[model samples]
Target: MSKQTQETGGAPKWSGSFGFIMAAAGSAVGMGNLWRFPMLVGESGGGAFVLVYLICIFLVGIPLIIAEISIGRAGGKDAFGSYKALNSKWGGVGILAVITSFIGLSYYAVLGGWVLRYIFVSVTGLPKSSEEFFVSFTSSTGSQIIYYLVFMIITVAIVVMGIQKGIEKSCKVMMPLLIVCLIVIVIRSCTLPGAGEGIRFFLKPDFSKLTPGVFLSALGQVFFSLSLGTGATITYGAYLGKDQNIPKSAASIAFFDTIVAMIAGFAILPAVFAFGFSPESGPSLMFQTLPAVFDEMTGGKIFGVVFFVLVLFAAISTSIAFLEVVVSFAVNTFKVSRAKASVISAALITCLGIPCALSFGIWSDIKIAGRTFFDLGDYLVSNVSLPIGGILACIFIGWVWKSKNAEKEVTNNGRISFKLVNVWSVLIKFILPIVILIIFITSNPWIMNLFK
Candidate 1:
């Protein structure tokens, strides 16, 4: 890391191990893991999808996370700078991660805006049913764009304050709070009438439903949920202390993040089942079904507020990471102030997000390759950029840079056990790329349509 970067409020390491773990977990446990995971589990046949997803997390997510972080910590630089230190062409890997994160945050903010708006109305008492309320709200152009802007503004404010004061502090506060909120919601939801049926549904696996699609869905979820292949871990790793164990930190982050996702499933599945709704309600399960579930309970408004507040915390934590990747790149690459980079990045994302925010309303009819702007962005990041980025990072680390070099970072320069280093290397070199390539191919619309 350059002294110039340190001089400009960009410390090369986190304040402590705990802070790094919390910040990393906060990055992984975002809106996708919370809201999307359960939906995916439901649609993909609960047990089988989850089983594959957990395996994917350990094999793909953990290894890639360790590799990305180790790369950053080794070079002590931004995502691109980290790779650029190794070789100029390797910077392309970092560039892909940044581009993925940039495009990812644009649509991600739009989703955050949706949650923010839902939070407001959850307290106001909707005269209409939850589904109708969601339909009406999403159909309005001005409301959608306004909420999106509001969410982006909040994101920008946090990033501008720098890492320690902003990112780490926020995560330390938000992660625990988010966990508590989810636990409370889960407790309440499980006690509802016939909630046991939903619990059974979630716990039970239909292995017969396993297909190429399920595997792909689970793999993609692991990638998106763990915040892998997005350069976030790489950028965050740059802020990691030299003495920290990359493997342990990566495992802890993945473990805690998986817990949050599971808790979210418990929070929603039982409530929907108790209310006699289908578990496979897809994306609308959160905005449509859960609101009505809360409304039926005593002190529902309070629960509603807490639920959406939990969601906002998750969203903010993720947005901070996405912005940090870009900000770090700008400060190091362009030699700009953190404030300038933060502002420029935020503004760029806001402008790019306008189409995504509008896709539900004014831009509903607009389509690229038979998908809306929001869906298109999601596909590009989740299916295309992410898988390619992960495979490339693995190839760069396992073969190009040689895993022995990364072994030092994982082992803390021989302080920790170096036993698993060989296994990690082999997986990165032989297993991950082939698996990701399969996922990448299956995730395509044409391929997916065939499976359907």
Candidate 2:
């Protein structure tokens, strides 16, 4: 808390816990929840996926979140440095965490570009409907690259402005706007004809669809949606004060994140049902179906504009958080200035993002493990980086680090009785590790199809 401790630490303290919460929430509430969650739900059989996803959030997501935050606060450093500082045995894992963040940001920015493109179209009233706009946009290679560049540039510029002025400021405005817009869209969608059916479809738990494949999908969604294993959470936690309650903060973040996702599902599903369209339209569900639904509504154009803007806000906020992990890692490990780290990280990620930008067009033919360039990037991050990073984090916190130290850091001035600590210990030592390992081994395509 002293000037010497603050200055030597070199990381900016969040203005307050609220700013930190919004920034963290902004990171978690991104394209995955808005664009990907509904599609996954539809594909895995509506309510079944939702049920399993919620279970995963509590079982796996909560413990790992606490571990990550505890580690970050304990180290009081950036992602890689934090891990390395914790113990030398974790240096490689720390570096992998850094790699994961960079890899995630690479393709993430490309998709963020797609959202940016849609935002402009929403403002200009071009393409008319989501379906038409997406078809036209994906039909050409040149346009996708141009739009991708625009998105990356915007992301880099914001990151270049430094954390307080750039990342925190943007989230303060964008997060509130995102919530307000989402509320309006949900209200409108609920009024549509046949909206009841859509709500029923989402809420009804079809226990029959609770297959292992569905479970894995839900697990993956929970991890990806929360931006776990990407070091974003770790870096955000590093900015916290000792008095911040780790468990309470994690629960709040998870609650808001899950609620926003559900709200998005509510907003989109009713409209999809009203339009008699399949909700399993994959990633393009939002881009294609929602616009058509809006087009038929009374204030379609206005809502369409608002929705795309919301998407842009979600994408940008998440991207900024993702970029922050890489920037923080660089600054902490190499002892570099924030400006240098930002530019270097941006340039590196931009180069890595080329294939993702071209995945729909020029590099369309490129395939690995039966996926396109973009798919490969996504798979690498979700299946490889995330699960692995999460596993290592759990092990480090539960086993590697001194238990008394971790317990003190996590509990701080607040009293966490032996019983609660025991429960957390059991989770980290037994439940979480085994589950993560099972998911990692079974995440293979062959194993997945066996369940199908």
- Kindly report which residue stretches of model 1 are placed more than 4 angstroms away from their true locations once superposed: 1-10, 42-49, 210-213, 447-452
Candidate lDDT (C-alpha), each = 0.84, 0.79
Q: Can you tell me which runs of candidate 2 are displaced by over 4 Å?
A: 1-8, 39-52, 126-132, 368-370, 413-419, 446-452
Candidate 2: tens digits of C-alpha lDDT, residues 79-173: 88788788977878777878887888888887777777766666556555566668678757788777777887787788788656788778889
Least accurate stretch of 10 residues (summed lDDT) in model 1?
1-10
Q: What TM-score would you give candidate 1 relative to the actual structure?
A: 0.94
TM-score of 2: 0.91
Candidate 1 lDDT, 1-452, residue by residue in tens: 21122322455557677778888888888877766787778667787778888998888888888898999887678889999987677998899889988999999998899889878878987779988888788878888889988998888888888777788888999999999999999998899889888877776788877897788778777877887888899999988877677788889999989999989989988888887876554457778877887788778888888999999999888888888999999999999998999999989988889999888888999999999999999889988898888889889988888888878778877987756788898998899999888878777758768877
TM-score of each: 0.94, 0.91
Top candidate on lDDT is 1
Report the C-alpha displacement of residue 197, candidate 1, in angstroms: 0.7
What is residue 415's positional error in candidate 2, in angstroms? 6.0
